[model samples]
Target: MKSLLSSRPVLWFLFLFNLAVAVVAPFVVDGAQGVMTAVGMGVVSLGAGISLARDRGRRVSA
Candidate 1:
């Protein structure tokens, strides 16, 4: 579980997915939908970053 969360590929995927959503949101959706999508993407990215950091810390401790 810790190893999986700390994986660089997983972090990169989260980043890229967020980037893709940000790029497409403007073209496909407007106003509230765009804002909601943006917020959701941000939350996911932040969660990924936090998880990665936490896993790395756990690995270092162990």
Candidate 2:
């Protein structure tokens, strides 16, 4: 899991994919469920981006 998270390409892909889903979900779905789905996706995207940034920082410092 840590190895996967540390991969820059994979992290970027996951972040972009989740961001795309979050952006498109509103037009495809309806009501509170749609909003919740978008929010969840956004959160995941943010987490992935943060993880990538942290990993990069650690690599630089080490």
Candidate 3:
């Protein structure tokens, strides 16, 4: 469980899940709810991207 949490697979899953939500949300929902979904997805994606970048930078620096 610890290894799984620390690895790239979890990050990939989060990224894909957020992307899928971003893509499908507008189709399934309407109006304000859909917009909020999109905004939340964007925030999640941005956080994942920043985490990936920081991890890569750490590896490179070390």
Candidate 4:
């Protein structure tokens, strides 16, 4: 589970999927809840992507 979540492809997919959802959520769902959920997902995936990039940078520099 941890490895899967940390994978670049997974993070990329999540980020893109969440971004699409955030864009479409308002029309498909009621209130701010759907948009909020997508935003939360985007944040999580964005954080994961940043962490992955940072780790890769350290590896190359070291």
Q: Which residue runs of candidate 2 sit more than 4 Å off their true CA positions? A: none
List CA RMSD, all candidates: 3.4, 1.6, 2.1, 2.4
List model 4 lDDT by residue over 6-43, tens digit each.
67788778767766766777678777787787677667
Worst 10 residues of 2 by lDDT: 2-11
TM-score of 4: 0.60
- Pitting candidate 2 against candidate 3, the one with the higher lDDT is 2
**lDDT, model 2:** 0.92
**Model 3: per-residue Cα lDDT at residue 9:** 71
Better of 3 and 4 by lDDT: 3
The better candidate by TM-score, 1 or 3, is: 3
Best by TM-score: 2
lDDT of 4: 0.75
- Determine the backbone clash count of candidate 1: 0
Please give, for residues 2-61, the per-residue lDDT of candidate 2 as tens digits. Answer: 787668898899899999999999889999888999999999999999998898899999
Residues 1-62 of candidate 3: C-alpha lDDT, one tens digit per residue: 85775467787777778978988888899998998998899788767777777888999999
Report the error of model 3 at residue 38, Å.
1.1
* Model 3 TM-score on a 0 to 1 scale: 0.77
Which stretches in model 4 have alpha-carbon errors above 4 Å? 52-62
Winner by TM-score between candidate 2 and candidate 1: 2
Model 4 pairs whose backbones collide = none
